[model samples]
Target: MNYENKSFSIKSWAEDDRPREKLLLKGKSALSDAELIAILIGSGSRSESAVDLSKRILNSIDNNINKLGKLSVLDLQKFKGIGEAKAISIITAIELGRRRRLEGALELSKIASSQEVFNIMQPIIGELQHEEFWIIYLNNSNKVLLKEQSSKGGLTGTLVDVRLVFKKAIELFSTGIILCHNHPSGKLQPSNADKLITSKLKSAGDTLDIKVLDHLIITENAYFSFADENLM
Candidate 1:
């Protein structure tokens, strides 16, 4: 009954309650977020189970996986049971998931609506900590020809080179383009600077005969569309 030195390892749990065993018995989809993350870390400290440690980590971020993904290795290492290797494992898994989403988004070849543009660009820039200006070039039929990052800057804003944007459009024979950028602050409202850049790009597109199809202010879970609001 000397409980002070007792171990609370995952191996001590019932097979059904163990993360790895449960994953093998049930399915990957059956596991909770903590269970999945426990499997990534593989083990826990002598006094806690992996799942328990994972729950504490998740609790710190209010169980927001997007917020979890934003954490750096040093950030994760601050957890009691997490070290450099385990932190790297978590970061790697999150990055792979992000890339998978990007691949899925790219499968949509045609852009028919503002929603489609959001679907395509959100995975690329939505959860970023800083700002990035992007352009989606489209052929005459609205099929995507290319998507490129136009600029990168701090949390406030990024500069878009209007001339370079059209230069690429002309080179690709793109007749239409969509402008997209992320607000790390999660604000959907277009700032005065946002409106100014949209107007600049729209006017430049007009002179070049390359239509500005839409301008999207992307956030983690939502977007603001200038075209949808009659601001185009």
Candidate 2:
């Protein structure tokens, strides 16, 4: 028997072992990360099963789903069994999950602390390779009105148009605004430019009676708050 070139199809597995059947019989939560991904890819190459291929892919990223989500289509297609379609399926699923999380975070009607701001903004810009500036517009009672991306830039920094920032704030009748931007470098410390921008926005907000409640420097895992540190 030439086992070297054999293909192990998912159908050969027992009902409980097949990723799709396992999900239908047990539950989605019952499936391992690789099993779920196996469902996405649907099939394997001549040398392995979909589950086996998924495991190998996950292992390449140390089994971190966040890292997996960051993989581009080209990046994923480099794997043995992952072609363009399978790679797209993985990317699309990851993106949908991210949007679901973002929607859940936005359900926070009222902003209470800097942590809440992070929860709302992290999904929008946290994992990016570039920088994005966002403003969280709030009513007098701290209830969120809107979150708008103010600008985008490269890995180093982004330009913020202070006039546009307050223009939307005024239009929304927002009494307060939270400034936020991501540091893709994952450094939580506010840089000199960060401080300067915060100062400029806070000064502008003061004139219009729109409070700059906090300015958050967001990263993938953590955040820094200007107000919390009395920098505001």
Candidate whose TM-score is highest: 1
Task: Give candidates' CA RMSD values in order.
Answer: 1.3, 1.5
lDDT of 2 at 5: 72
Evaluate all candidate structures by whole-model CA lDDT and list the values in order.
0.94, 0.94
Candidate 1 wrongly placed segments (more than 4 Å): none
Task: List model 1 lDDT by residue over 1-232, tens digit each.
Answer: 7676788888888899998899899999999999999999999887888999999999999999999999999999999989999999999999999989888988887889999888888888999899999999999999999999999999898998899999999999999999999999999999999999999999999998999999999999999999999999
- lDDT for position 143 in model 1: 96
TM-score of 1: 0.96
User: Which residue segments of model 2 deviate by more than 4 Å?
Assistant: none
Tell me model 1's lDDT, rounded to 2 decimals: 0.94
lDDT by residue for model 2 (113-135), tens: 99988988999999999999999
For model 1, what is the alpha-carbon lDDT of residue 220?
100
